[model samples]
Target: MRLIATTWQPVWHETPLGWLDRYRAALAEVAADRDTLVVFPEYAALEAAFYGTVTLDARGWMQRGANHFDAYCDGIRALSKDTGATILGGSGFARKGDQIVNRALFCAPEGEAWLEKQMPTPYERALDMAPGEAMPILATRFGKIAAVICYDSEFPPIARRFAEAGAELLLVPSCTDTEQGASRVEIGCRARALEGQMIVAMAPLVGEVPGCEVIDVNLGQARIFCPPDGTSPEDGTLAQGPRNAPGFAILNTLSESLAQARKGTDVSVFAHWPESETPQNPPETRNFR
Candidate 1:
């Protein structure tokens, strides 16, 4: 399977159609291959309100997002069908009844599913976005896949659960304003790939769109990683895009890549992972006195 990790830049427009066209263009570029999977970063949907239909401030964006959430999802569904490619359409605020939740929409040729962000950042919490339930291992034709949205990728157990559940690919969609923030996400992606022995791909929101308070300043490169073990690239990075650039980092993976790696490698991290989870005996009770 070929995957495209997009480094996207948000821009304010006078009309939603104009901004939506840019998104369509990006999807079209990836869909040209048909079988390729594309991943967009967290908060990519918030860019729609950047057209100024809603206030450019954080509060305004969230409110408008709630109001227009359906249209946002419908558009992605249409794109998925039209392009004939699977897409992880990035995270956004979606209303789940009375409360708004931070959710990422995954659209495949077969169907669509929502992967809620299990963890919320301070910025998101301030916006009253609710945390999601535990992640699920998603089944797909290419292979089983899982999602670790933004900050959630930093937590090892989230990816570990998915891996144990038979996920071969991990998708991480993120947004960060500073290089330091981006690095933390990048490190998390690398770490997950190393320990899980699966393909980890991250697409980050990049560049600045003035007036969009929530994502006004963005920084990060889109990249794909695999285990550093001998079965895959020694460095673990399969592809990386230029920093703060708007483009896609594309790479191909075989159906048996992860399976073969787990079975053939000198060090079987995936197999050994279960041992780490073995219940430990109660700690010994001893007093220095």
Candidate 2:
């Protein structure tokens, strides 16, 4: 399967129609050859708040995003239908009652589904955003997939459940203010791919949006990771893009070498995963003499 991770920057002045055009152009860039899977960065929907006249704080921005939720999703749906590409439309704020929740929408030609971030950053919590309750593995024609929104990618349990559910691909959409923050998420992506023995791709929000306080001075890099064993890249990095650049990291995930590495490799981490759970011998405590 071909995968493309799109590093994006939110435009503070774009209207709903402008957003539609931007998404259409981005998806078209990757889907030129065939039906490709594209992942966008988190909080791309925050740009919707820019339509308002007032300067919004974090919570106010999230509320504005909630107001335009449907239009945000509809743009992705139309793009998916038009380009015949499967897209993870980054994470957005959705109002589920009086509380706001951060959610990621996955759109395909057949239909659309969504996943929420179980864990939110301190900044998000301060904005009154609620964490999600469910972790679902999305099923698609190419492969079973899952998404971990920004900070959630740092938790192994979240990614493990999806890996256990037979998901072959994990998409991570992140938005960080500093390069250090982006590096933390990058480490999480690589760690999860190594442990799960699956493909892990990340798309992060890059560049700054003038007058947008929440997204000002954004920093991130697009990257794809595979197992570091003999089956894939020794360093586990399949592709990486220049930091804070708005572009795509396009690569082929389905390789004969990777398939062979999974089945028979120098060391099969996927095959030996159960060993970590079941110990050969139980620990015995010895009293000090």
Q: Model 1 Cα displacement at 252 (Å)?
A: 2.6
Candidate 1 similarity to native, TM-score: 0.91
The residue pairs in collision within model 2 are none
TM, every model: 0.91, 0.90
lDDT of 2: 0.79
Q: Who wins the lDDT comparison?
A: 1
Stretches of model 2 off by over 4 angstroms after superposition? 32-34, 253-261, 278-289
Across 29-61, the per-residue lDDT of candidate 2 in tens digits comes to 665433578888888877655654567766666
